[model samples]
Target chain A: MNYEAIVIGSSAGGLSALKSIIYNLPGNFSTPIIITQHVSSLSESYMAVFLNQLSQLVIKEADAGEKIKPGHVYIAPPNFHLLIEEDFTLNLTVDEKVNYSRPSIDILFETAALAFKRKLIGIILTGANNDGSNGIKQIKHFGGHTIAQLPASAEVPIMPQSAIDTGCVDKILSLEEITGYIISICH
Target chain B: MHLPDQLNNIQNIELTHFFELIFNVYGYDFRNYNKAHVKRRILNRINNLGLKSISELQHKVLHEEGFFDLILRDLSINVTEMYREPGFYKSLRNEIIPILRTYPYIKVWHAGCATGEEVYSFAILLQEEGLYDRSQIYATDFNPIVLETAKKAIYPVSKIKEYTLNYQKSGGKNSFSDYYVARYESVIFNQSLKKNIVFAEHNLVTDGVFAEVNLIICRNVLIYFNKELQNKVTGLFTESLIKGGYLGLGSKENLMFTDVFDQYQVVDAKEKIYKKTIFSSK
Candidate 1:
């Protein structure tokens, strides 16, 4: 099968960036997308509501043990780490933060790597920290396609730079191009 | 100590052995857990301890004093908060509360209670609903360290804001601040909330039925286990509950694939609350 899932991670300055890509996706873009964006725990479930208003696809905060479905976006809520279980269901953990970030992009990407294996696309976007670098590496190790946002195009370059440094990034593209590229590869 | 930049397939063997070591030594059976989660947690411990490989970490785990606790904590994965998934709590207050009121005395078992945030949150809800006097809540976790913290019921004042929002969303009728007293950097919840609570050690994996509770709340805990363990824990939950008693799982958890799938009737499917039927479907 082709790519079954796409996992994206962002940190500081992630909200607007995520909106730009998610809102721009074509109506038929149905591959399941999972996102982990660093935010204060105080944000609660507001991020899901905010993103749902922008994207045409069904968007909601991921809950533990929810079955993963195509044509929807699952956002990791603050103060929790999201993982993909063996059964392709979403799992949430209140486990200690990774890279000082709960809902760490790395955790979601790594688990999705195992769950989706070769049929996965891992994207690391703008974030001030190196949270998602190792995750994308894991994705690449599992033979999944890995993409990193071009550092110059990011609000914060450190995160993408770290992923690029791993030498595992298969492509580096602008958010606009990334959106178009995602639509291009699947169907 | 020669660590590669990337994990090779051969590393899977070492990791598997590490799980075996943990089970043999500590009796925490994580052999069949989701591999990605297991690997990540193992990698975390390896990095944290400045160890180079899983074998070395396993050696340390077997030989060192108190080293296993760190691994146990990592394995426990206790990231939880008050009034998580506000909708579920909302359903409990609006719908389950009335059913619970039918019982002269209520017993609730918060299996894998973590830091007792939910238990405390439920206590606050019970107090507000005037049901605290008639309730006995057993908050248990295999990780006694967290259980001790749960017993303390003190939380960083920083988290209270989000929790306050959750409380309001879950249909709190009173001021959220009334439940907690800000003291120093932490907030101390009212002692009365613990009046009906029993905090203790209970491992769902290895332990048996503890009580015939009216409700068993085991949210976000089952997802860590593999299918076999998940079913096993569900069986424990099924047996521990009285007939027609309730079982409230985490929002994403469902009875769809479990052995007890047909044994309970859905009370609120969205909220993952189920009531036991008279006959156990075996």
Candidate 2:
């Protein structure tokens, strides 16, 4: 399937995992990547800038109403639930924290699943919570692809393990395998 | 389209029809809200009430007496806290209050004021800065139930700790404890804070411009709106403000992405404070 968008979730121990995953994509990669990494509500805009410097993907914090474009990376701003509207534009919300986190993986994954349907891919990486587990299921329910990082290979295995527990996970690939699979399916 | 996709389309249609049923019967419009947000909230109501589907929910909403109020409350989640973003208020006290001092009389509208926590927060800040006497504050929310609750200024005592920390961080001049009397499970704020404040029902979706003011403190409210509604609300804010007036949005809310982007200059970038440009090319 030619996937148009990718939604990724990570929490504790997410930094290196995100870096390795981004490192695996080619310089000419051309699919939109949306990510939610758990950080303090006071976290700054530096994550996007730092990620952009290290990776080929053009990364920036998602601004409200910005059109979702291929080949770009959009990171959810701290303390806001980044939603995908029907028109494929971004909408940020200060709604109550879901799964005890704003920019909750479930909110992003579930909304993206509805918006992108079978054309979306959801990946769950190292984290401490089960925020993305239900989200990945929504993607799968909509006939989309779902992947969880191999628990043993993850810095924190609990998150991906939780996604695996859902039984909706399509694959539990190693970081390298995940990257290869993403490139193979996208664009 | 595939079967499930077609089914999804059907559900969407049902949801839109539900919105219209609501507007027609109640005269409260929600058709302009962000659809995904509306869909999720409606689905939550469906699941919570153990209803079979959105259409089922719609039937109950139309036929059952007072059922629409329950659904209305569900749609507008009054999930907010006092001094929610401390830094925004700190910036207001340090940067914006000085400018407001210039006016002999200042009018501030707390648009989408939610449950009025931030309205009281602003009042406290103004009182601390000694600007309360000359200020007229209008606090509004579409949810009338929350509006009444706001007028009482009572909050769960459980939230006091967080509000106290936020108060301190927001450069509060006095002990946070002094502002409210904590009795049992709730804390009642000082009644004097409500003196210059008027709490009313103002729906950002359908309400017209009601006040021409020096500042509009609407934070974190516009995120619920789609691109079109966001622009419309921003335009209302523009028309509501006097020339060169101030608008403070939530930290994550961007004034730059809207069609009205050029109409305002950033007054405090970090705090998301914008000043209406005196002369607009548009």
Candidate 3:
């Protein structure tokens, strides 16, 4: 399916993995990127600021009712679910926590799949839980592309392994290869 | 397996089972919660359901519709009271109310607000302070069904006597009974208390910031999370709060070990209240 957006979900080793992929994306990369990194309720927005320095892309915490833009990266603020809207805007909800996570990768991926349908690419990365598996299935069911970081290469493999075990993933690439794959698909 | 082995196995499988059950049926996440708490709650749920094993509880939940609802109530910690602790509310009135009065409008996030009693108590306090008209309270919880109960604003009338004592201790100016009507055995809180409250479902473990607010009150909820999850949640509140915004935590909660420790100074240490300090963006 042709994709205009990428939704990524990770935990545990997500920071380094995400940094690797974001760092590789060119400053001119035009597809929108959304991330749901597992975070605690007491966390600060330092992750956004930290990621902003790693890439030229605009990085900010997703705010309720904010618009999604290309060349920008939106990180889920701590303790709230972040979903994409059909209008290409961000919708923040205090809806039920998924997978014991507010910005649950599953919640983001599932909602994004419904919103973007086949025009989306869902990636499940390093983490210790099966948070993203069902979400990736939804992405595949919606006719979007689905990928997981190869468990052997992921810092924490449970999340990736869970996604792959769902039998819906189209590819399982390392963090370094994910950037190229995303670029190719979006282009 | 022996009891220890059985408990450990349940601990390991409980989260996975809970996660699957929530996603496939309820769409909620209990996967990353502190394992100890999850196990305890799951055990309590099993006992409540009169099941012999975790697998039995799981089977019942997966096969029996609406069983998830019962399990959710058992899993969720809803032990709360109006004017909880009294002292914290008193401190809020003494230290925070005056400051809030200066703003043209006030926004407060009462995170993990269970059953709505505490939210209603705060609303009554705000009304007594004459700040209700200018304030908006966003009462959020992970349990939407509980939130619906909160929105209903009803409680057992038997609890009102204790709530009255708490209200008085919390520096309430009028009789607590003024805010609710006693009907039969239940107390129906004044509908006006919810006028400015917006109830929504939010998971502190995975959700993002709600809004730029002057005050955030998340009590008792953080104790359910592990240190990593706690730190992440605190960071979200710190970022969502405006400069000089106030953060109030449960009495047992603290920021000493978090990355944001130096970013906030305790305002009323005894009350677990803090005021954010200006810091350079990371």
Candidate 4:
């Protein structure tokens, strides 16, 4: 399938895992990748900039009303839920936190699943919580592809293990295998 | 089209019909709001009501007494906190207040002021700067329920700790504790802070221009709107502000692609502060 977008969720021990996958993507990587990494409500994160330096994708914080584009990475801004509109643009909300997370992975994944349907790819990486388990199910329900970082390879295995428990993820791969699979599937 | 694609088209038509039913019957224009946000909210209501689709919900809305009110409450974004973005408030104090000091009397409008926490936060900032007496704050929201809460100026005591931290980070002049009286489980703000403030009902989507003002703070509200609604409300703001006035938006929102972008100059890009130009090409 020709995927249009990829949504990623990560939390504890996510920074290094993200670096590993993002740093390996080619300069010509064309699929748009949107991510939500659990950060403190007050943190002014530089994760996007930090990742951009070592990666080929043009990485930046996702702003409200932004149009999704190829060859770019959009990180959810702190203390806001990142939603995808039907037109493939971005919408941010200060709506009540889900699973005690403002930039909750479930919100992003569920909205993106509705927006992109079968043309979407969802990944759940290392984290301490089960925030993205329901979201991964939504993606699978919509016939989208789903992947979870192998729990044994993750720094905090609970997150990936939780997603695995949902029986929705299509692949369970290590960091290196995940990066390779993304490049092989995405055009 | 494939089966899923065909289903999506049908769903879109149903949603559009639902929005029209709401607008015509209730006179609230959520027609041009963001689709994802609206859909999420409506789905939540559907699940709660044990209804299957927007069609079913619409039927209940038309037949059941007071069901629309529940939907209205669900649609209205009432989530807010004092000093939500400390950097924006800090910039307001250091950059915008200095300019407002030049005017003899100042008028500020908090458009879409949900539940009024930020409204009181602004009032406290003005008081600390010794500009409270000269300033008039008109805080408004379309939801009367939230407006009533705003008038009371009381909030859960559980939120006080976070608000206090936010206040200090926003360069508050006095102890954050000094601003409120904690009574049991709620904290009521000082009456002095509400003296120069007026709370009212104003709908950004349907209401006309509110008032001529020197500053307008409509933060985090426009993200709920679609492009057309955003531009329309922004035009209203442009018509309401005096030349050289200020406009503070949510950190992510901007006039960059809007119809009024050229009329305002960015004062603090990071904080999303814009100053209306003295000479507009329009």
lDDT of 4 by residue, B66-129 (tens): 9888888999999999998998999999999998999999999999898999999999999999
Report fnat for all candidates as fractions from 0 to 1. Answer: 0.51, 0.60, 0.00, 0.77
Candidate 3 deviant stretches above 4 angstroms: A1-187, B1-7, B10-26, B280-282
**Which one wins on TM-score?**
4
Candidate 1 CAPRI assessment class: acceptable
Q: Write the per-residue lDDT of candidate 3 for residues B1-282, one digit (tens) a residue.
A: 444334445555665766676767766666655443455457657777687777787777789878888778866867678887688999999999998898999999999998888898889999999999999999999887889889999899888888998899899999777888999999999888889999999977668887889899888777555567778989999988888789998665677767888889889986799988766252
Best candidate, lDDT:
4
TM-score of 4: 0.97
Q: With candidate 3 superimposed using the best TM-score fit, by how many Å does residue B159's alpha carbon deviate from the native?
A: 0.8
Instruction: Write down the RMSD of candidate 1 (Cα, Å).
Output: 3.9
Worst 10 residues of 3 chain B by lDDT: B1-10
Superior candidate under TM-score, 1 versus 4: 4
Error of 2 at B204 (Å): 1.5
The residue-level lDDT of candidate 1 at B71 comes to 87
Candidate with the larger DockQ of 2 and 3: 2
Tell me which of candidates 1 and 4 scores higher on DockQ: 4
The digit string of per-residue lDDT tens for model 1 on B1-282 reads 322324545467788888887888788878867666777788877888798778888888889999899888888857788998888888989888998999999999999998889999899999999999999999999898999899998999999988998999999989999988998999999999999899999888888987899988889887777778889999999888888888998866778789988899998987899989978653
- The regions of model 1 sitting more than 4 angstroms off are A1-6, A11-34, A37-80, A85-90, A112-121, A127-130, A137-145, A151-170, A179-187, B1-7, B279-282
lDDT of each: 0.87, 0.89, 0.82, 0.92
TM-score of every candidate's chain A: 0.98, 0.98, 0.96, 0.98
Candidate 2 CAPRI grade = medium
Model 1 lDDT at residue B151: 91
- Candidate 1 vs candidate 4, lDDT winner: 4
True contacts reproduced, candidate 2: 0.60
Better of 2 and 4 by lDDT: 4
